[model samples]
Target: MIHAATVQACLAFALLACVSVAYGKPTGQASGRNPSKAALDADQQFDKGSGIAIHKLDGAQIENLLTLGKVWGFLKYYDPTVTSGQRQWDYELFRVLPAILEAPDRASANAVLVRWIDGLGPVPRCSPCAQLDRHDLQLHPDLGWIADTRLLGKTLSRKLQRIHGQRRVGTQFYVALAPGVGYPVFKHEPSYDDIHFPDAGFQLLALFRYWNIIEYWYPDRDVIGEDWDKVLAAFIPRLALARDSATYQLQMMALIAEIHDTHANLRSSLDVRPPVGHCHLPVRLRFVQHQAVVTGIDGTPPNTSMLEVGDVIAKLDGRPPPALAREWAPYYAGSNEAVRLRDIATYMTRGPCDEVPLTVRRGDHELRLKVSRVPLPKDYLAMGDYLAIAFHDLPGPAFRLLSPEVAYLKLSAAKASKATEYIKQAAATKGLIIDARNYPSEFMVFALGSLLVDRPTLFARFTVGDLSNPGAFRWAPPLMLEPKAPHYHGRVVILVDEVTQSRAEYTAMAFRAVPGALVVGSTTAGADGSASRVTLPGGLFTIISGVGVFYPDRRPTQRVGIVPDVVVEPTMAAIRDGRDPVLEEALRLILGPTLPISSIEGMYRSQSP
Candidate 1:
């Protein structure tokens, strides 16, 4: 239990506030250490830990906890007193947890909940509580659980229904949309950075907090590929029984992967996840034709030829890459299978600094070789070249004329302010290749998009959270690109790959809106929309694509991504020969058969990786 004195301090402080609820404060406080210090901590916050402990739970306990989680989350988002930021909801969970945990049966649990709700005082009937307009809504409040009398007794159910009906209006203290972007800004979510490993109560709190955040605020919950409520039930025992910090983190990663979003992952550190090591094989790998193929070699002069560029890495350290990927899939969060495999391939060869055995296939010959792992290059670019795709710092200026006939612009180095200059420079060219093969340095959605069109063009639309009605989302008007002076009248081709994500994907959607613009490349990362940070207990951090991004006609772009008009994946031979097939295809489309691919002048001189 929370040190008695600390619980006393919390209750003491809560009592000083307006007493509306029936229970003056939470009845249950989890057990923890440092009584005197904890008491002082309680005067401020739950700084030490949630004192609750857990062992094995029976079927009945699981069911009871599931219902409790639903009820707690419902109250958090729906009840006016809680939603208005008047209550320390996390502490309140600690207070009520013990009573529900010890309840003998469903009725007993319901009674405990009833008292908790009653103590929050009475709900006043609002004259104009926000109501959902089905026509304009992309998602509606998921409140069917409130009427589940079989789970919540009639009295408790009635109380919940009343709270939902008169939910808080105006700006909610918990969440708000960004000033103009419309992505959710989770306010006042403390990281609880002091706790290296949280106790059972805080673990349960993490689960409850994350599950509810997605349940109510995630715009694409309908497409999460599984019943989210069931997910909550399944993970409750897993998190509660986690024996150590590593186990807890693994469970958390698995939970995050269930959301099927590339943007959602444990961002605090990569060391926690698989391929955990300080050194890696001195070669870059990319998934080509469903196989891990060497794309680029790195390090000093050696840059090793032991594994040739086109060599297919069938096995690493005697383990097949695919098998390893399968083992790590649950922890690798991604939007779709393509991007999932793309990410897995990036780190499959990373491990200890030792001679790693590898089975390689060169044409028909199968060869075995032991490659030495080296510390990543001291320079960021060299290390990036050795491992994952370069996030920024593409080789040349953002825009330049590849030739009089072809204009090249890579968004990785492009500046939005130079959009006019870029357009003017490209005006005389027959075609412009806007490379979006990496994350853009700036948001070029309107800056460059405007210079490509002759009139207003509809590109994308969005779904934003409804402040008054939590868990509900409405569609915003379609975004448009207004024409700017000196518009480029040339044909357009966009280059993209798995490295293209979020803003890059959004920029592609905007550029593709122009007439005759052709997108040529393999599937993209698929995770669009602005990312919102989610901080959990135990100092863990993650993100969710808060807003739903869609094409103008309401075609979803979350997991499906921006499908290219011309699909062109680089061939193994092309990688071995230092060629970019995707860029070649763009050149082919623009230059036609009249100009030889080799004669494109400066096109391949400073080709970007």
Candidate 2:
């Protein structure tokens, strides 16, 4: 039987913050740690070992997948010699990998990777395993530095590539890495199966995760504080509870948070997607000073009040993090930021019961307001982009209002919700206008291909992972030629602005493969192909990479964005009012075959993603 006292005591010591919700935080006080003497000594030992001057793990092949610099950092922290008993698997670099990393017959060496990771049954057919097989493997540019264990990790990954079938929830699947060959043994259950690095051991994973960037952060941390460890290990009782699935998702997102890089991290999947649907508020809010400040309202009762930004949060009703995590504490506590900051995220993203009551504090008075809840419009559900596709908030058309016959739809974020029904509404229209102003996810363009493809034609395709090393291969999804519904049999014009980047460029490139699609506007934000998200220790999170998109032809549309078929720019004067010269030209092209009465060199023809 689980004792409540023991559970509470262990909760204090375990430092596992399990307070989790479906989605996420703020920059308040980061959860700080003061190292005990032992932890300090361990840190010293790690530092002392660094002087040993082990060669840098440099290799083009594995760098793309493992990022050698990062892998070495993590390994040094875990320091394989350290051991964790509870862990199901461990890693040994030399015995497991020396031959492969040093091998000149690279293909033979690469083949070992497949053997290392492909273990057990009900595996190899899984999505991860299959995707691995399809990827272009880049051999290590610096083959000499490849660690046996890290190579083993590559091998383990190869093994994992074989698994088939899928679990119902979560994309960051779990795999168990056995210590001996450093192979992957488990496939299906990523959550229950804990992943560990034998060298770094499991004593302090946060350091490997948190300190890698060496940005504006340096904190003293201890895995086992004297008072806490003694109290928990001797006096506390053992506690085991079934993990909540939602909390685990929250935890996974937290892992993404640890890697602040925009391009590299975990993905649910590019093919299968998540629900873009979200519970929204009647009012628009901004995070001013750690408070959910109201900005605009769709004319709701509680939101009608003139609450401006810069107001401090006085109090929140049950919707606050404190209130939400009262039932599930660890997720809130385990988060990377101060606990208070998490409360703020909850206040923003989470739906409120009945009315969401808030107390915004100005100088002397505390204003109380209650806002009625509403669902966010589907098109507007994007993370950081303005929602479009006939959205009501904006003034008339972003492009030419009547680019006579041409209908343009440009967006940044593609969320899974009915608010997004606007796209269907767009694809069904006659003339086409696609504003690749600032693209978001690759899945949006590829996933939405069904909506655009009237016939089976190629979209865009590009190589994923590294394809240099002898062993490494490419991960290329099909260039979607199938349409979601019927082809919108109309003249299609796509507009791209300077901000057209990553997924935006990919979307533009996708249509370029089509016969009649024309790209206009200025250069795009270059960086394609990044289905990335970071994973934090505990439950912190972030994302990585600059782009997550690639053309079907396996060409790069990065640093240098996609070029427009028709080179038309927008002017400042035209932008001041409601004028899109490029869009106007597109409309002209659709309605009439002639070039515009306007000049060829214009500014942004339309404002879109």
Candidate 3:
């Protein structure tokens, strides 16, 4: 019954189809205003329309996931001023509430929404979440979900037949973030503005998940609604923007910033070398005007000539070294120069650097340096796993034993060789003094508790993320030590100052609750557990805080640092002469009325480089 022209058109289309098939085009690859009939059918079938698509989730899910994302961005990150729990949720609630009510079925989706709003476990919150406690919204007769609202105020038996096939994604995001893996339901509440934010990883996740609901559900509004397309449209372009290492890093930071918790942040790479040479810089640094300046250097080389003892470094590469610290700002983030300098030193070497270059200015003349760098001694390199390494060849230490009886372990945080070799050896002797007055070589903090006992123990527990999927990691106490491999339990004392930070603090804190141990020194720099890097907005980054470490009793240590039984301080003269006042005090405490100063004096006086 078809006309001749129709027949010709059909034949020509068939021929083209054969050619296209010969070229091998995959399904779902072609998508646009115009597409093959088959491709169009597939797109329509998987076309999750608006928020919850009519399409089923399958192969195209990742692409459809582009439907929403909370990528970290500098501009979108709510500032501290705007981030109070109530205000943030208020911004989201007016947008999200209606979505839940208007959901295909609110009753079926109630449990999922409530779970994400659950409060933190141990973190103190004045009140339960405000957003989830709202009562005006209709709940299913069974009081279950917001998305399954059609069942609300209706009997289950009456609705069973019609509601069976309807499926909702549920408020899965919120449920995943809330604490204790339980559903959220207000046992008692009636307030619009009473909600406060949650702490811990689960809480943060809940807050963001709550915001995402408004972002998706409330499509249009004056100040209260959200536009998924607007956010997605804005972000997808940036995601597709030409990728640069710095920009890529920035984008990741932006994603992290969206959570905006002091304890939450991005991570960077840190290289651990073989245990080799010690870090011996012939210079001293001081914090002047909130900037760390080189107050002393051994000699003025061709590139380092412009730098002096009092020179201020304006920019580290293109980033501000001190300013970027706010990103992760851990419990010990800004406690000392040692911590800050360590961050800078590692940041400079993140990428390959045959000859590391730096720019420095003394008064007016600008200068640059190409410093030679080396890895840890090759002999000490031993790989255990991607996450662990043990290096050996480190240079002469910052602290050394002056006396055999007054055993001394100088902690240098050197790569390759473990810096605590002196302490381990001294632990076998009568009295032990640890010097943390210098920088760290490597972040070998896992084995500290292992040296104290011959049985396994819980050294620390790291908690990350918000209340929901808050990740927790435990360090089972090690049962063995290197070298002698038995518990040498003896009189142990540690010395610390501002330079004792990061791994230094970690190593020092490990001694807590151990028998016959004393921390006698000034407060440590307090920058432990966190790893930092430059992230977004050109030189901006998230110094993601580490999960808080805890004692056996599950006491969290974050804002508050480890307290030493006795506090010791140092003098400039003592530093110059390489004598530790803290060590002197520890010796006094351990030696008590028995040992005489003359007995230990000769050993410390015999100096050997």
Candidate 4:
């Protein structure tokens, strides 16, 4: 039925297709027109036998590579069979990047991806594959690029759909489901060998890995206040153009800061240790009311007479303190501007010189002083023994009766088991004061909260990522504090400040579940949820709020922190005078001023009887 000429032409076309695939070349290319010239040149420059120099990529090349990375990471996580237990999927990404980079045009790049996808064998059907765990409530709706049908095509799309079907769900990126019986365990260790700076491949790998994680799993991405996709695009050129180790590290720090999370901070590398230079001022500074205030001085000799406590720092080396804080903010990570400025004030004392010229305001006088920068002492960073002090007067044990009818519990040193004993002791008390002004020595959310409520209460909820559906989040089961027998039916008051964070915030939430529990004081530190460490190239380490934490009603706790029912901020005068206004307010709320001495004495007598 077919002619001899037709058969010959078809055979010739088939042979050309095979040759093109083998050589990674575009089909029907003219002899002189090399579509892959720029890409090939880039590949040649980067591939120097040891590793690819990711920093050497040009703007166009970097864009292409980022696109490739996005698609590659999506498949790596969604399609488990891509690695096939032979090598790590991240390493596989590094392996295939060069081929993609060698494709000069979009069509050629897509062709390269198609070839790579083809080589991934088949998407295996795993009936017992774990369903995605969703524990945090942060959401990112912009990650549609992961499953864009135009990029993935029918075959890969159908494969993903088939995998979804195995889970009894329709094709969706983020799936909603019930909490699993157990938590999913993850290896916190690094999966790659350590490499120094200027190793562009490792740098790119770190950036891509972290970006994908945040893109797919980070719950509070929406609150980040920046276009994360644009951030990724902008950083590609910046990371690629990083000239040295210090610059690269700064770039990485800046990148981490974009999340606007206090938990997100880069651990110092050997070359990048803080106070950022060879020397630092002996004084610790705190940002208060937008002014840099000297808080404490480490016993380094030269500057004790020059700088004093309560002095306001106006300038650093002729630059305004506010401007300096702005300049240095990108180097520090915090949940909000207040925390960022606070951290900046602390770290801004360091410089390359032996002495830093400072302008400080003492009362009404502005004085310029040359403060010597000394090596920070080993114990300089320690939080002093003040937290061990019992709150207010009534203090035999951490938990005691402030008044006969009022119970005071200092959570900083109290244990979980102690909560049970304290509840029994304070059972008949009319009011309970929980001082969470410091970090807890032990977790007491259930142990303490259970004895406060008469019924099971929803304390908080978590929003976690669905790995199968990257960039999607679903609320986990509400965390409830089940009531214990002999529950204390008393009004409760909890204290909080910036010092209260993470477990403290969580504990506050649990206690806040009690009926008529009043949260007093200013906002707590906004960084809540379990921390997940991220290791980068050059042995740099960092952490982030690995989960989303929220009130049962879905009010976000991250960045926003725990808002007080009655907002109260400690005054500068109060700190200087050693006044416990927050605690005083708690006492006022519990014991009215009109209560007579006879009544108080009668209440104490009743307790003894």
Q: What is the C-alpha lDDT of each candidate?
A: 0.76, 0.36, 0.35, 0.63
Query: Which pairs of residues clash in candidate 4, taking residues 3 or more apart in a chain or in different chains?
Result: 135-462, 135-463, 135-464, 136-463, 136-464, 137-463, 138-219, 173-469
Give the TM-score of each candidate.
0.89, 0.40, 0.41, 0.76
Q: Between the candidate structures 2 and 3, which one is better when assessed by TM-score?
A: 3
For model 4, residues 378-447, the per-residue Cα lDDT tens digits are 4322211122111222224568786767887877778876777898888888899898866666667767
- Model 3, 1-609: lDDT tens digits are 223233223222221221122222211122122222332224332122112212122322222223212311100122111122222222233233333333344343333233222321111232222122123211111112223334222332223212222212221111121121111211111111112211111122222332343232211111222243344433333333313433333433344333222222232311222111323223444443455455444444643433455555555444554664443333112333333343333232223424445565555766675444434323211211111111111125544555555666555543324434544555546766656555444433333444554444334443322221111122322212222254556776777655554455656776554566788766554434433121222222223232234455555444344556787644433433445456566777766757675554445555433
Alpha-carbon lDDT of model 3: 0.35
Candidates by lDDT, descending order = 1, 4, 2, 3
What does the lDDT come to for candidate 4?
0.63
| Candidate that would win on lDDT | 1
1 versus 4: better TM-score goes to: 1
RMSD for each model, in Å, please?
A: 10.0, 18.3, 20.2, 15.4
Runs in model 2 lying further than 4 Å from the true structure = 1-142, 146-404, 410-430, 438-455, 462-473, 483-486, 499-503, 527-530, 536-540, 545-548, 592-609
Model 2, 556: alpha-carbon shift in Å? Answer: 1.5
What are the runs in model 1 whose C-alpha is more than 4 Å off? 1-45, 196-198, 376-388, 391-395, 593-609
Model 2, 502-599: lDDT tens digits are: 44556677777666878877655443443222233223333333122345554545334687878775443343243556666666666665654453
